[model samples]
Structure formats: C-alpha cells, structure tokens
Target: MPKIKDKAIIIGVDAVLPALLAQGVSPHFITSIDPQKLTYEKIADSADQIKDVSLIAAPYVTPEVHKIFPASNIFWTFSTKSIESWINSMLEGKILTSGASTCAHLNLTAAIMMGCSPIIYIGQDLAFPEYRDHAAGVVLSDPDQIKKELGVTNQNTVWLDGVSGGKVPSTRGFLSMRNHLEHIMASNPGPHYINATEGGAHIAGTEVLPLQEVIDRYCSETIEFPSRLHTALQDSNLSNTKKLLSGLNKALNDTKSLSKTVNKYDKLIHSILHYIRSENNNGAARSVSDLPILLQNKISNAESLEKKMDNRKHLYIWQILGEGTMEDVKKSECSLHEITILAKQPENFMLSFTKNLERLLSLNKARKNILAMFQHRLLHIINFHRKEKIILKKIEQKKNMEQNLFELAQFYFETGNLVLAQPVLEKLLALNPDSAEVLFYSGAIAARQSKFEESEGYFQKAQEADTAMSKRVLEFRRGLGGIYFDLAGIQEDKIYSNLSRKMLFKGIRYCSNHPKIKQEIIYLAESDLTRIKSALESGTINDVETILTVWHKGLEENKNLAPCITDDQIAGFHRHYGELLLKKGDLDGALKSMQAALKFTPDNPDLYATAAELFFAMQDFTNGITHLNKAVELDRSYAILWENMGDHLLQTGEINDAIAAYEQGFIAIPENINLLKKIGDCYLENGQLEAAREAYKIVKEKYELAQPPRT
Candidate 1:
C-alpha cells in the first residue's frame, strides 16, 4: 500500500460539510462515515464531479447503500481484536484500531493509519451552529419537530466556543466528540491536527484555520497520488471469503452442540412440571425434598453449555460473519447473565428456575436459526465468487429444510426485502401446505403489500391449519384482525369494521394472558372507541350499546385470564368506562365505577381528578373538594389540577386557600389567559383591589397581543 504523507480530509456529515465543499479543498481522499448521507443524490453528484477524490467508507455500510455507491472503498474497523487480526491476516494489511463508539473515531484512526501528516478536519462541527444540526443539501429532520418530540426547549442549551471566540449554543453530544478528538490529538504527537471547520466547537490541541487558507498552504503543488484501493479490494474479497466460510463451519458445529444441550434442559423442565402436577394429587413433601437436587443438576448443565459458547471465538463469530454487531453480542451475554442470576435466587426457586429454562430455550432456538441463516448466506457468497450453482441446487433438493428456509425468509422479510422473501415462503408452502408458520408469514407479506384479500385468504388458511391453539396460531389470529381493520379503513364499510372487531375479540379471548397480545388488543379497542365517538358526534352511527358491550367483554376476558395485568391499566380502563357511562346519563353507575378505579390506583392524580368530577356531578361538593385537594397535592405541576382545586376551594368559602391555589396554577402556566383571569377574580373577591387591577392589566396586554394587527 502507498503511504499518505500529505494532508487528508476526514469528511464528517455535520452541518459544516457544505462550507468545506465550497472552499474547494482538494485532499488526496475523502473519508466518509455515513454512507447514506454521502450517497444522497446531490452529495454524490458533487463528489463525482470532483476528480481524483477517492471515497473510503466504514464496513457498517448496508447492502442498499453499497448498490448506490459501488465504487466507494470499504475498510474493516472491527470492534474485537480477534476479528481484526483474522481479517488483516487474510488481506495482508495492517490492522487499524477502531475508534471507541462513533464513526468520527474510526475516521481519525483511518487517517492516522495512512500516516497522514498535518491532517485537516472538515465538517467536524460537533455542535449545532445557530440551531442548524446539519449542512445545506443534506436531508435531516426539522429541528423544531425534534424539539417538540423530545419535549425540549431552547433553554436546554450547552455552551461551546464560538467561531469568533465567544460562547455559543451546543449540545452534550458535540462536547463529548470534541473531547474525544482532543484526547486523540494529544496522545499522537507526530502529526499536526488542524480543524478547518469555520463554525463548531473548538478542540484544545488543534489549530483553527479557514479551509481556503489550509488548501493554499498544503496544496501548493500537484503531486501524483498512487492507487492501491483496487488491489486492497481484491485481496479482501479472496481472504475474507475463506475466513467467513471457516467461521460459519465452526458456528454450525457449536450450534449443533448447543441444540442438544437445550433439548436436555427441555426434558428436565418437563420432568419438573410433571412432578409438580403429580405432587398436588399425592404427597408434596417427597417432591419438595428432591426439588433442590433437580434444580442444581439443571443449572449445572446450563452453566456448562454457557461457558463453552462464551469463548471469544464463538462470541465474535457473528461480527466476523457480518451478521451482527459487537453490541448485539454483548446484549445476548448480558441477558444470559441476568437469567442465571434469577435462577440462583433461593425463594420461589421453581418459578425462577422455570423462567430461566424458558429463556435459555428461546435463546438456543434463536441461535440455531441464526446459524442456519449464516450458512445460507455464506454459501451464496461462495457461489458468487466461484461462479458455481451447487448450493442453490442443494437447497432446492434437500428434504426437511423447512426450518432453514423459514429462518432465511424471515431474515429477508425483517430486512425489508420482501421481493426476495416471497419466493422462499412460496417454496416452503409447496413443501408443507398445512404449516401454520409458513401460511402466517405469507399473510404478513401480503398485508404489507396492501393485498388485503389475498392476505385474508392466507390468514384464514393458517387459522384452520393451526388446530393446536399454539402461540403462532394466536398471533396469526391477531394479524387477521389487523388485516380486517386495514380493509375497513380503506373501504369504510360497516361489514368489514364489524368483522375486524369480532376477530380481535376472538384473538383476545384465547391469548389474554400474553402481555404483548393484551397490549395490542387494548390499542385496537381504544382506536375503535375513538372512531365510534367520532361517528356518534357526526350522527353517522348510534348503536353505542353494541360497541360498549364488545369493549367490556374484551376487558373482562383480560381480567379473568391473568392477575399480572398492572393496576394502572385496570384503573385506566375503569376511568374511561366510567366516562362513557356518564355520557349515557347513568350518574350512580358512573360514580361507582370511578370510585372502584380509585381503589385500584389511589396514588394516581388523574384518577383522583376524574373522581372529583364524578362527585361534583352527584352534587356532593364536600367529597369533590376532598378529591381535588388530593389531586393537587399529588401533582403540583399540573396546572389544570390546581385550577380545579381553586374552584372547589372557592365554593367551600376558603377564599385565602383559593387564592393560593390560583397563584400556584399561574406559576405552572404563566401564559394561560384563563388562569390569569381566575387569579384576578380570586383577588377581587378577597378585597385586594390593587392586586386585582394589576392582574387585569396583564390579561389585557396578553389579549391585545393575541389579536391580529390592523391592516
């Protein structure tokens, strides 16, 4: 490889990128981290227009992006040293250290590895300059929308050194990046670091210079830049392909061993469950005496397998195969650790041990699926390079390959490549026409493509094939209901809407014990209720009793199925149900329902407010005052709660407490015109004429400001 002694520009996609492009700095190479940003039509067009500016990218660039910018070069910055060493051995290149989390760190490492002297940084603006987070011509989210979504305001600002030496607004993310860069520059003493970004947070050890000046000083003469990128690509392809195949073979062997271990654990779980069941009929003391021994044996077997699979080679195999990240591997290990800890607890040993066994079984299943998918992809890669059609034929002819095909199709579906996944599912269906799992995925793909009729047919077929009442079947039922809901939305037909409601009710009846399925059912019910309310308001429909009956039935089924449903959820259901009863003029029924909701969730401020409203409707002013006081005490920041408390206090003849409540309300909502008027009224009623006049003046100014200007 050629050594890069001249200055190189590490182009980050920060807001200052356009500035550097405008300055016409022709560096030897442009090291880009975010390929999606770089491959934006305008940015790519600009880069293509500039000759001899090679684009080097990080390895995490997705396949779609590679298709967009095929000419760009990629370098491996693996997080683990083993993968790095493996890849470097194959490619015969020096392994460069990956910058710890961010792509900017990787870019810096790349520049240092190239032995670039006087490296110039452009578009490294770690802070938002003038509230602009990205450069012109780069597609980004609206800053105002981001602020609103995150519930942030302009007041949440961090200070950074401005372009001209004063402090400017920055974010914590920018400051951390700046600190990392400064530390890197400080540790490496040979190269002179220069920040060419005209506006951004300042680095302590780098000289700040304009891009034009840096270009004039560094690019005084045209020098020949050598080409080694093509050779590097060829070497990487040949060497990495072999290494990937090797890793896949080892992973396949490990997965087989892990599968056997998991099967053994499954048998142990079944034995334990059987013993527990029989112990209920027979004597329990003998079973209880043997429980610890069974638990210890199971735990020991699981721990042995866990240690065997926890080696660096197996742990990093996913990253080496280009299938997952280091973070993903770490997360899997953390989950295992937590499950192990849960199993070790003394109290509730059976429940904890069973939970751990279930989690381990699930993890093993996922690992097996991943291993199969990796094998398929590796074969595809090998065929691509060697120009052979052997693996494809083997996949087609192999018997009992349903699991592998299903996993591969599921992977493609998740990665948003339905085009590739559809044919695989079709083949799986042909092999096993009555497989519920295959039919369900077929329906899901159809639904995603907006072919609701075809999706409905597939879902109905899956439901028929699923005679065992398995979890897959229940989820398919939910999917079928969602399809009907979508069809109703598109056609606005009453028949489809009723079908949607009926199917959702059926699915919830069978799977109300599942937390995820229960949540989905609740979301569907709430959405339908909103639609019903809108129709009633517009005189489009008036059968409120039928809709309420369906909703009540679903909630009742959920309550019967599991005690794990949270108290907060039950309270919310009762509160909404009570409000609906009030709308129907059943005052006594509404009051009872609201009181029951409060019993479940006494600390909930919103529920208290609802109870207050219910009491006030019954002409029980004293009870209403009590609930309103509780509401305000629970949440002082809620302006509406404080306002309601003031209203009730004034009714009870506590004028001083009312004034204090209104004042607190004003503090929570300083710009509320109604709150200001209420405060003024309280002051006027208390004989504070001067205070009332001041409040009225402020309200008047606010009202005038709200009015339109004269033309």
Candidate 2:
C-alpha cells in the first residue's frame, strides 16, 4: 500500500502459509483466490493485529469473507472489467490486468501496480506435496463428498518435481496452476521473484530462498501502508465511476441491438427448418444450397451486432452470463457450409438437411435464453444505478444446448462417445474443408467406428493438407499402419491382403521411428507369415522378397530411431528361425541359426543361457559351462543366471563351486524360495548347521509374510 519498492511476499497456496507465519514473516499483502480456504479465516483474524498488512480480495470472494475483514484494511483487485463493473460501478473502467488466470496472478499484478518490487512468493507450492492434496490446516473434502458434490472424484495424482529432485505425487490442477504462474512470471520480467515456498516443483526465474532470508535481505524495519492504500482506493473509485457510467450506457444500447439481432436469427432458423420439413426431395436438395443465400442477411446482421458488442460485453455481465450463445452463432456458419455440401449429394440431402435444421433450432433456442439473460442483467444494473426496485420478468427454464461445436465434439471424442462426435466432426469439416485439425479428428472418429477405408482416406487427406509434414505426418502414418494391420487381419482375398501388406510396409517406411508402429509391423508380418508364404509359393505375390528387403531398409534408415532395435530383437528373429528349422529336423541349420543369434546378443544373459542349453543338448559341456559363466558374469543381478551356473557346477560334481554359485543366487534374490532351499541344502551337506539354520529361517519368514494374515 505504501508503494513498498523493496519487497512484498504474495501468499496464495495454503500449504506454505502456516510455515511462513510460524517463521514470523508478515506478508505485505495476503491474497485469497477461494474464500473457502482455511487460511482466509486465519488471515482475517490476524489482519487487525498485523500492522500495515492489507487484505486483497479477488472478485470470487463471498459476502462472509467481506464481513470478516475491516473495509479500510481491504483493497479490492478486479480480475476483469466485467467483474469490476458488476461489483461497483465506481470501480469500473479501471485498467484490469490479467494474471495468467489465477488469484495468485491477481495478487502479483496488484503488488506490481502498487509499486512493490522484488516480490517474494510464499505458500505458492502449486503442487500436492508428500501425497497430501493440501497442507495441514487447509480444508479439504473427502473423496466421497467430492464425488457427490462435483459428480466426479477430485482424487487424482500426477508426478511433479519434489524437493529431493525426483518425481513426487501431485494433482493435475496444481500442475496447471504452476504452469500458469510460470507463464505469468515469464511475461512480467522486471520484478525479481524469490520463491520462498521451499518445496514443490521448481519454477524458473524465481530464486529459491528461506522466507526469513528473503525478508532480511529486502524488507525495511517499518513503513506506513494503510493510509496510502486507503487514499489510493478513494482516488481510483472517483476516477473509475465516471468512466464506468459512460461504458454502462453504451453496453445497454449494445445489448438492445444484440437482442434484436438474436430474435432475427431465431425467425430465420425457424423459417429454414419449416421449409426443409415441407419441401419434397428435389426442392429440399435445392433449398439446402439456397438456404445460406436466404439467411445471409440475418447471418451478416448477427456478425455486425457481435462485432459492436465485442469489448463492450466485458464492461457488464459477460463473465456472469458466460460467453452466451456467440459460440453457437459462429458454428451456424459451419452448418451453412455443411448444407452446401449436402446439396451436391442428392442421395442423403434431406437427412443431412433435416439434421442441420435441428442443430439450427437448438442453437436458436439457446441464443434466446442467452440474450434474455443479458437483457435482464443489463436492466438490473441500470435499476441499481437509478436506485429503483423493479420486479424483473423471469425467463423459462434454461435448456442445456450445445454451444461450442469443437469443444463438444472434443469432449465426446475424449469420453469415447464416437457416435456423438462424428456428426459434430462432419459439421467442423464443412466449416473448414482444408483444416488439418478437423481432418485429424475426422480420421480418429472413422477409426473408432471401424470404418477403416474412411479412416484411411481421412488420414491421407490430413497428411496431404499438411504437405510440409511439419505437424501430423508421423501420426497420420501411424494411423495408416494401424488401419492396414486391421484390414490385413479381416480381409480373406489374397489381392486385398497384398494391398494391405504393401500399405503397411509403406506406413512402416514413413513411421519406422514410432515403437508402436514398428511393433504393429512386426506383429502383422509374423501373424500373416503363413499366408504370405502361400501367396509367394503360388506366385500371387511376386515381390515378396523385395517388400521384406524394403521393410528392413526402412528400419535401418530411420534417423529418429534411437537404438530401439535391441540386440535381443535381432536374436529373437534368429531364435524363431532356429525353432522352425529344429521342427524340420535340421539340427545343423538350427545350431547355425542359434549361434548367429548369440553373435548379435553376446552380452544378453537370457540369450547366453539359451545358448548354454543348446550346447548341453548337443552334448558339448565345455561350451555349456563357458556360456553359463558368461551369463552369470554379464548380469550378476539376475538370479536365474546364477541358478543356471549353480546347476551346471553341481552337474560337473564341483560341490564347493555349486555352493558358492547358489549363495550368489540367494544374494541376488533373497526372496527366491528355491534358491534359499538350495543354499540350505548345500550348507547342510557341508555340515555347517548354523548357516543351514540361517537360510531356512529366512525362507520361513518370507513364506509366512507372503501368506495372508489369518482371515
């Protein structure tokens, strides 16, 4: 309030506030986003006791919060002009700065405007720490209560940077708040932000320090703030009042014009719906194209009205009444586009036309309610300024009409409601014929409906629309691969299967870096191997060898692929071939293939173990022991490798070596019951009764713990 140029700590998060308060660091100003936080009560009680400390309230503050704090000690910060005008016309026309959409942001902006420099942030953890949603003393509802009240449980966790520099459990909401704060800080660069919250995700551009350290470094001993704040508020009120009244009159006139425009739209929508329902097939098809021309005047009128109402709405009831039906009005333009497309297709013209009519009717119904609400609020504001008590006419029940086509479609898509999303996507596509975003959504919708051909077309179109392949080529190729894989599985015709195979290969060529795409390619190849072999044998697929060669070449050439193809994957290919050869009684060929696999995955413990087994089968004990030892040495953490080494040593009649190997296995996996038992047997055989008892005791303890406690 005193234009403290040195420092001011803005407190928002409840988690860190109590800790800062305990440290005796009085914040310059305390801000509350939600009046319901437990810290608000604490702050209110301490406001009178703390000298020069001001309480800043956001527009969302309840009446109860106002009563708790003295009026003189409270300085209001308006988040937007609409909020300012609605609360007090005296505070209207003030420069309302946005703070990246949070009350913390509002506090930061207020502090900056109040001339507080080098702001210190406390209790702005912006993350759920230690698996706790909020800090101690912060009010939180139970999961069941939240689910009942909000129709969804608030209990969710995400990974955030903990104090220890590792991921800790947090909530998505906190992460979002943290991201917004970071953006705000980035945008406002002059004032240095010192993060004294101490724990939680680290925010860039804020120096981390203890609250006391920050205070000692920047704060002065004593300062007069309350008197300055009071005077400033009075000056602002007087200046804003005059500007607000002028804006209000303009808003009233704009609302009247918008209301008439909405009425016109309503009449036009009704006319179009009636015409569509009454007309026959040929007439309806023609009307679909002609309807846009008929309603062009009304659409243009609505747009002009909206343009005039643009920034003026922010001066009145825009925030309270919501965005109104402007979104629906804008989407009507898209409906007109769809109608034009429908006109060209006479086969489904009437059905599509009727659907568009129904949408238009829905939009109009919503527009009427929105306009009515706006008119009512404007009248109420005018009456308040005039000091008149007038009974206002109440509108009927508000029917929930879909306002934003894109958002609604997105919601349906995310919720797995493909059927609901498809028509909306079609409308979107009509609106922007070349929009890659709409094409991508359309492709997704088709894929979910299992319309593979349609999905393929949409995905290809999306890829083509984004010719630079800067945004969607990878995703499109992956989608195409999935479609072809599905098509290959379902199609019985050899020619179709071959085409699917070729497309899949092409998709793999384009999206070889995507692990899922690579895996899908491998799956299709292996699953359809027999069919492909038959096709090759019958000379139906002449370029089988060429396709396989190109597939391997693509995998090798992918620059984005970062060693995703492991040595084990190479070994797996050889192993599969070896198994096939073994089934054909080709022992020499099988051995050669297995040896080839070992060459690629020399350090792979499992491959070494498999090679040892193969050697044992060939009665080559020397090579078996060599491979087993290599396996154990390569991965000492693997208990199986140690066990294999122990088994080989025991078979060779090396009792001491066998006991050592078993002990090593037990060390690697102490919970391995089999290894534990083997260690005990070896100890017992060596007559070491104490060691035997120790091993058996561990086994018994582990076995008991693994068993469920009495019921």
Candidate 3:
C-alpha cells in the first residue's frame, strides 16, 4: 500500500484508515458510509495522520465526523437523485458516486468515476484467512465479532477460493460483499481491478497478483500526481461554493420558522383529538361535517409546510425524516380513497402525524445547527466571507431544542409509542446520527418491528459507540435473544430460529465476563438446540432442508458451547436424518443417510440396523439380509437384528437358513415366543412336518403362558 501511494491515487474506506495512517500512507480521500460509531471512531482515533487527507463522508455519518474535520476537505456523498448531486452536476466540482452499501464498494465506484486506469484493490480480504477478521491496525471489538460469526457455523461456514489457492473460512456477509465488488468489476469492464491481498478469500473478477508484481508490472515509474490533483480540485470548484453558501444561509433561517409552526400544530392536534373524543364534543353539538372541514384546512397547512421542507436546502433533514404526512395518511387508511376518512380514524394516527411534523421540525433545527458547523468551517473558504460575519451572527441557534426533541422522542419510545417515537429518532439520527443512546433506542424500535438485521446493526453500533452503556446494552441483547427464543419455541420458523441462535451465540460471547449471565444464555441456546434435535428425531418436523439446517446449527452451537453436544448426540442427529427420510419413503435418501451415519459410528449396531431397514424398504432382500447379518455380528445379543435377518431369509426362500437364524434369535432372547413362531413357519415352508409341529406346539404353549387373563 505504501509502495503504490506515490504511483497511484489511493482511496479506501473508514476501516482501512488505521492501516493507512499507521503506514504513513496518507490517502487522498478516506470515505465513510456506515452509520456506525466504530466507523467514525476509527477516523477519530487516527486524527493526527488524517490532517492532509480529505474526507468524503455520507450524510448518514455521525456529526462527530463533521466536527474534527473541516467542511472544505469534507465532501458529502449523496444519492444521484439528491439535489446536492444535481447541483454538483450543474457546477464545476467533484461529483461523487453512490456506490453499493459498503465503503470498499464506494471506493470502487469513485475509482471508476474518476477514469483511473488499471484500478487496483488492496486490503479487501473478505474472509478469515488466518482465523482473523482483518489485517493489523483494524480494531474490531468482541461483540461485533460474535455477531458476524453467528451464521458461520462449522456446518455452514463457507469455504471460498483462497488467495494462495487453498480454501479459507468466510461468512455470508463477506461472501455477499465480495459478490458486490465482483459485480461492479463485471459490469464496468473498462478498468482492470487487481486483488493484491495475497491471502484470505479470492475475488472472481480481479487479477490475483502479488503486491510486488503489481508494482513491477504497472507502477515502475514514479508519477507526480499530488500537484495535478490539487490543481484540478481548485480549478473548477469555485462556482458550486457560492450556491452552497447561499443555500446554507437560507436553510438556517427556514428551520427556525419551520420549528415554531410544527410545535403549534402539535398542540392543535392534541386539542382536536381531545375534542373529537370528548362526550360534549367541544360543547358545540357539532356534526362530523364541520370537524372534517376544519381537519382538511389544518391538514392543508401541515402538508404545505412539509412540502416546503422537501426541497434542496433541507435535503438532509427531509431525507432523514422520511415517511412524512403522505406515508402517515396511507398507513392510517386502508386505501387512497379512505385517506379522506381521516376524521373517522383513531387518535393514534393523528398523534403519529403530529409527531412526524414535530420531529421534522426537530430535524430542521438539527439541520440549522449542522449548517452553522458547516458555515464555521466553510465560511473561511468562501467568496461570501464579506457577508459571513453577519450571516454567522444571524444563524439563530438554540442547542437545547434538539435535546428537548430527543427527550420527547425518548418518552414516546419508552412508553411503547413507536409510531410517535420512530420519526423523532429518525430526526435525531439526522441530527446526531451516531449517539449511543439514540442508536440503542433506534435498535430497540427496530427489534419491536421485527427488523432483526437492521436492529442488530444498530445495537452493534450502539455497543461500539459508548462503553458506558455496556451493561445496559448487554441486558438489551439478552432481551433480544429472548424474543427470538420465545418466537422459536412457539413457531418453527427458520427466520426466528436463525436469529435466536445468533443472538444467543452473541450472548454467550458478550456476557463472557458475567459468568452467571453467560451460563444462563448458553443454557438457553443449548436447550433450543436440543429442542430442535428432539423435534427432528420425533419426526414432527420433516422438511428435509429444515432438518438439515437444524442438524448443522445444533452441531455448531453445541460445539461452541463448551462441547456440550456428545458424539452420541451428533450421531443421533445424523441417524434421525435417515429416520426422516425413511418416514418420507425416500429409500435412496434414507440409505445415503445411514451410510453417512456409519462413517461416524461404524461399530454401532444401531446404524447397521438402520441400514438394514433402508435396504428392506429398497426391496433388495440380499443386501437387506447382509446388513442384518452385519448388525448381528456387531451385537450378538440384539434380538431384533436376529429376528429381522430370519424374516429376510425366509422371504427370499432360504428356509433352512431362516430356521437357523430363528434358532440364533431364540438363543439371543431365551423367552422369545415370536422367534419360535418364525421357526415353525420356516420349518413348515421347508415341508418338515414333525419339526414344524413340535415348534408350533412349543410356540403355542409359550404364547398361551404369556397371554393376560380375560377381565
């Protein structure tokens, strides 16, 4: 990486910043995309090394990222549909690309957009090559590692093409990410991408060359680019600066005015709600007609204000606080036409809409504050500096208002009013996108709504952001695990099972310091594994995929949990697979299952007996007798095995052999009446009248002796 800094324009993600900084390779631009504090903390921890580097952060990044870095060097990445991108397209400056979700994907997008030739990918090892997540200098915490390792069980862990040609362990996330990068490479075939990690998972679309070889082949000459890069940046960026400055100035004022109006609407909605439900009905005896008319007028005013916030100036707040009144109206009604029946709706919808308005205003205020921060950094670099002093003075800012909105949101969230709290948190996220408290609540809300993956991401970010909330976060995680656990118990849904097991796995990991909690969570997880295994064995759940999935998960989970799962238990799961296949009448599948089971326990008589059963189901009487003979040899006293061998022989017309097998069965169990009857049947079939008569007479006497008396 250091070798290519001088030869090529180096760009990377937030995760690589520490590695880049440690090696003294100042990236031209280090971009951030995840709304994770750990993502921002990596940048914060490398503050000293990042002075000369520009930061191109997405709008979803935390405000702390915006604080330490200057706005002049901090370019924001926006969606192509965004007004900022539209303005950039019209202006003479750097136009950023909206890559696929990951930072490395974004780096590729940027590299492709810049017309860079032979773009090389380094530090993109999407696998645990050495049983480690990343190379040196990347500080991945324990909790997140537990979470990532959730699905990568011993049974299901993916083995992909290794950089040095052997297979390596990887998770689904890394595989998906690699797929995305490969797709980008495949779609845009112009620039050649080189994967020079030389270890970890191999990428399909990249040239697998070592770093030194890449340098020798393409970077033999040291090209001077720093000056040209800075020159090109300065040449065509002045026009966009003024337009942005003017928009910021106007946006600051708009938020203050917008906030007061939303607050007013909040009070009115409560008043109207109270009146609508009141027995006296505002003491006016008013019909429904008058109220709907009043509501329509209020709705129009609120819609007008919301529409005003939906423009270019308020893009951050508008985009962040999505699902405005229109979404609310739709959710409140069954159809578009029923949106007109707003008056007939419950107060919850009204409160939700008003909450949306209030939080939108809160987001507007947050935007106001953020714009001031932007103006503080950008004011010095602008042509509008002559008007900057007055403009900065007129940036009507009250910091506590944002906090008050957060408090309001917290109250609603805590009281189980997610509809009201959701918009508020969305607003707060746009304000302080990575606050540990806000992120935790956001995750909690997502969990309640069954957005398990999104919830996990938020919880992980919250855990990474603040160590102070460690205990609370741990408790919350247990609660989340319990939710999945309960759902898994009641419904055999694969989604719930996967989620529960993963969270329980994380619980076992994160609560490692808390021995009691760790014990409890592991027991819960282990119990669930047993539960699924029991279900499979009982033939209650017969879906082949479900059976196999549970089988794999149980092995992995039990292995991870102090090797609680025994060889017998694992063999049982495998044997149950054969049992399920047998139950489904899949003779070939059941045979294959028994064959696999025998690999684990070749000496176990039960597996051979199972193979004999499958052979009987397959109607191969010869192999069936052979497998039963093997079972009897392994366990001479297994009466069922002896009896089964006699039955198979008799069915194949080997009467003498059948009679001898029945004698062996009677020897195995001396009080066996069934074997005596089988011997009589075999003797009779062989036309030996005296032997058949004697065997039948003995069988009749024993059968009569074993019979119960009539009541």
User: Pick by TM-score: which candidate is best?
Assistant: 1
Among all candidates shown, the one with the greatest lDDT = 3
- Among all windows of 10 consecutive residues in model 1, the one with the lowest summed lDDT is 1-10
Give the TM-scores of the predictions, in the order they appear.
0.45, 0.43, 0.44
lDDT of 1 by residue, 434-522 (tens): 88877877876665443445766877788788855345645655564443334223333332233344444443333334444455455
Clashes of 2: 0
Clashes of 3: 0
lDDT for 34 in candidate 1 is 54
In model 1, which runs have C-alpha deviations exceeding 4 angstroms? 1-53, 81-93, 100-103, 141-156, 226-244, 256-359, 362-711
User: Which residue pairs clash in candidate 3?
Assistant: none
Give one digit per residue, the lDDT tens place, for model 2 in 37-154: 2333334323333445556676666433444333235656665544454555455434565633556776677767766677777666765543333444332212222222232244
lDDT of 2 at 639: 59
